[model samples]
Target: MNDFTPSRRSFLAGSAAAGASLVIGLNAKGALAAGHDGALVPNPFVKIAPDGTVTVIIKHFEMGQGTTTGLATLVAEEMDADWDALQIEFAPADASKYANTLFGMQGTGGSTAMANSYMQYRQAGAAARAMLMEAASLEWAVRASEITIDKGVVRHGDVSAGFGELVGKVKETAEPPSEPILKEPKDFKLIGQDLLPRKDTPAKTDGTAIFAMDVAPEGAIYAVMARAPRFGGTVASLDDSAALEVPGVSAVKETPKGVVVYATDTWAAMQGRDALSIEWDFSNAEGRSTEEMEAEYAAALDGDGPVARDDAGVAEALETGTAVEAEFDFPFLAHAPMETMNCVVQAKDGKVHIWDGSQFPTVTQMAVGAVTGVGPENTSIETVYAGGSFGRRANMDSDYHVEAAMAAIALGTDQPVKLVWTREDDVRGGYYRPMVKHRVKMAVGADGKLAAWQSDVASKSIFTGTPMEEMIVHDGVDHSTVEGVSDTQYAIPAMKVSVRNMETPVPVLWWRSVGHSHSGYAMEVAMDMAAEAAGADPVAFREELLAGSPRLLGVLKLAAEKAGWGNDLPDGWGRGVAVHPSFNSYVAQVAEVSTDADGRVKLERIVAAVDCGVAVNPDVIRAQVEGAIGYGLSHAMRQKITLDSGEVVQSNFPDYEPLRINDMPKIEVHIVASAEAPTGIGEPGLPPAAPAVANAIFAATGKRIMRLPMVDAGVEFA
Candidate 1:
């Protein structure tokens, strides 16, 4: 055997205890976590047990996105371990080791889970495999270079042993290589395979998956909050005598956000909250209706605000050419995640423990710690499975979590409080996708070529008062406000894109694809209009402008070919195509629609093509694309969060309905295969769905519906 000596990692030197397991972390200088059975406590990503179970610690949240399965594939592929013997768990809130490299924070959003952790998990798995091979080399008196691991078994010629058998000696004699070699794409066994089922699917299917609502501690109490009816409204007076008299009610406490009612269970707490009476003060609240807000936004577009992108000679060029003007008004949209917002908070002995399906755990920990007088380091967070977030749970204010912590503090911190928001609360809740208005004026020269393009966008900034403002906002212009327009890959010459950030008392958040959600719609619809003005086919016009973006063009061509863009459909049906790139992924979708005599649109079918660089899990990518199309179509067809006299108009799904089962069209997703690094797939599929459907409606009927929730524009779905 070769005498191999490894330089001990400083972080793991004195922390290692005599044990029969190995733990490898993503960072060489990370802190030690408490390990099971006095094993090496250092590192936080990969752990090998004495029983041969390879546990991968996932730092991202999985909300029906298959993040767990995608992340675990990296480790299993590099370690050459048996996929069936592997398990996964969520990492605790520790930014030092678990921070996303893209955001410098421990959070999951923007579909950046796989993009950020791909190399980290691979390195972790390689390090563990290196240590195991060295351990087996020493135990069997074989050369480390000659030992090979295949499907969880270590072998040297005829001598063979399982990873569990050699793990006991890894900590005693073997050392992890500082730079472990990784497998190439050609040698990968599980990275691109679709047969390896998702690890979380079985639990979710068998009713064994534990969501935030399933958490029940021994002395846990249920809490429900009754907040003001309007955004920025405050509690002026409160009477809790009737609430206290309700059955199973224990106490009602008033906090800054709202009044919290604690009871023995969820039903009792909801009943108690309903029984309480509170007078709201709307002196500084938002009293403008949707129409008033729309008017103000429309007025803001009349003048230019902060410049996101300014090109010279655009004004002089527009003086002589024909201008095609288009305007769009989008209403505030609710996330309306299925589970609502719920969390379990426990505070005792000046420390706090929070349990939730946290999309932003670091922010939640800091917010809860500040509320309970506990430092962030002392606050512990346990992330569970989320039903759905879409962008609701990752609040900068940590709204629901902070409320739960305050309730625990007010109720004497002896018991845990499980705070739940009813569907009504969720519908009326503040943080919504901001209402936006876009005005695009394109000047075409006599030669039928695009000469000048000026786009003015107005919307409430989602990052103005949040922690992300400093990173995302630039030069007094929130980059998110003009993302899709300012960063368009279309070859438009002499373009000027400006953004006007409007002030609003109502809170706004980053919906699925952030700014691309509305910007993509405005840009795509305007492109279609410009194509008509130029007397060219929509697909041909896009092809002429998209020469600079190969990925975008690739998907557009693929989608058009798959959908038979130029082929004649049924006599009444018309087709439209839209392409958008968001979160580093490019997606194109084509919709087939037929309009009734009254201009009601009936979506016949949809075909989507996505180029997300590399497909980590093809199944997951296809599923996400399908879901995104459905979600996007649902809002575009008939969903809006309107406001009247400062009160939200829609209370439940009836008014703001999701797409009915029978309403969903047949969807087909095609993925482009490439050798580049993998990108996000969760959100890119959404930006094109709405615009494609809108364009299809226009194609079927010669009328253009510029506003959102087409029903309001007198364009209903049959």
Candidate 2:
């Protein structure tokens, strides 16, 4: 991916270098620019030199989302390009050249890349193919309709010419049709098929994946920081005399928030950082703990705040005797990606280069450029595949990158400096999913149906202070905070929802499903309770509420059918179902669970059905659903990050335990086929799992556990 904007001269130069005889005029943007004009183009332009070699530039950063292969498929499909002869390269960070339409930014998130770019990339491919076909038709003196393209070659009867051979003669032609006919889905030979893993699988299996830890630049020193233990607490002072005396330790620098220890390698840096003595500022804590935050959140729910949505007289309805009230609590959660946080940076000759496994490479580049007082053009960001992101890598606080860049400058060495955050640092350093409390009141009519609903959600705004805050938050309501609930498909006569922003010192971010994680739990659990109150089957109850939504009803019916919703299960085992629409996709899940005599609950199976329009790759879609169920179940079962005196208490896997293979459930995924453009699959599957599991637990034990980590509610699993 050449991030550089291509000037006309550079475009011609590049084409010539590839031995392409065609005179290619670049868009007005300079070569390597991310945005072309005002539009984002993450697809790379390929040029075949007269020498027959192909170069492909990719715009989206590759971070294990299979963007590399997905984007490549679009180009190959359109170009009729020879896959074996083409080489792929990374695009540079230039927002002007590669803005994402879904985010209106130059990066990937929200699972919108594939769906958004599906058509644009195909058009790019079709244009290239048209040119080659025309060139072959001209040479063969045959009608263009008689020409066919296959593997980078244009064929007319027995005559054929490679794309490279036709490039020179095809230059300066009018642009191909803007709305070229797309290949029929049935005719797709590559788009929906499983592609051989291209980049990471081999590297990881062979232990050569260049994660941040593996980035060892020449003369690269190591730096470690002793950051504030408590959120928003700055370091008062540091005693680095002993740290400087440690073997291989070179220098110690004081930062605004912490002390940095520089050494020859990571081990030395770790030793020096440990030996350094630092004075803490506990003033920011004010004795606030998780219990205190929980109380504050509960208090806010009772007071007036911002009204996000109001459709009817919810207050009057809730005030009547026919209403059911329930409160659900979700604790703060840590991203806890396996790789932790680390960045390697080098500053030399007014140029900054960085190597990091970040989900937000453009943001990282912009932050580095801003902090170093350099132009964005002067910075280079190289993205490596992250072990896992789950939104942690999308940090607005570029603490790791800033520390490394500053250390490199302070050390006065052209050598790169790698700053690593230990597992403890990563855990204790802020940026957690906001803890949330929901107070819900629903009015049930004598007819056993919901008449009106009122919900008050209290939580620290995930968007209040981040770069994405303005775009995601409006009218004092963070849409990310009420996704599943606000856009619920259920048909209630009236509904009122309000959000009270709880200002807390803890830094929060959008975790995987964002608000859907907790909001889905609260909404679905409430729905299940309503169903039980109505004396109706859960599936039938949901179907009645979702009468008008065909897509929702479709998934709901499919999931229930697959889970054998009405069939009798073994004694003590119960089934629960939940449906949600997010990221343009509708998902429904049914969880089967059993409770032992001693009250231990075990989730045995999960049946998932998704209507994501068209399934570009059914296998990948199923894999995503399975992965989300596993992740969602982990959070539902025991994943939580508790704060003690404003500091995270869970430091590693031992404390924040995720599910293991032994706890794996039998997962069945069904994709509802449609011709509608593909919607997201990455995070949508997650929102329904927790609620489905909770609903199942309620069926098994007749207990409506309102709090998360069912463990917290004393709902133990065997």
TM-scores, all candidates, are 0.94, 0.91
Task: Summarize candidate 2's per-residue lDDT along 1-718 as a digit string, tens digits.
Answer: 0112223342233223222111121333323222232222222455455544555566666656666666667777777777666656666665554555555445667877677767766666665676567767777789988988877777887788877677665534334444556687777766666544453356679986677778888888888888888877877777889999999999998765477899898889999988989888878753578898888888877789988889967767667637688999998888777787888888889999998776655566656766666745688888766677778877665657767776776677788889888777877774788889999988877888888888899988987756556677899999988887877888888898889998877778888888888888898889988877778888998999999999999999999998888899889988889999888899999999988888888889999999987776677788788988888888888988887887788988888888888778899999997889888887899999988988888788888888888889988888
Question: On residues 266-371, what C-alpha lDDT tens digit does candidate 1 reach at each position?
Answer: 9999999889989999999999998898899989889769999989878977887888999998889999888889999999888899989999876776677777
Global lDDT scores for all candidate models: 0.84, 0.76
Off by over 4 Å in 2: 1-56, 82-87, 161-181, 194-200, 207-209
Q: List runs of model 1 lying over 4 Å from the truth.
A: 1-35, 38-42, 596-599
RMSD of 2: 6.0
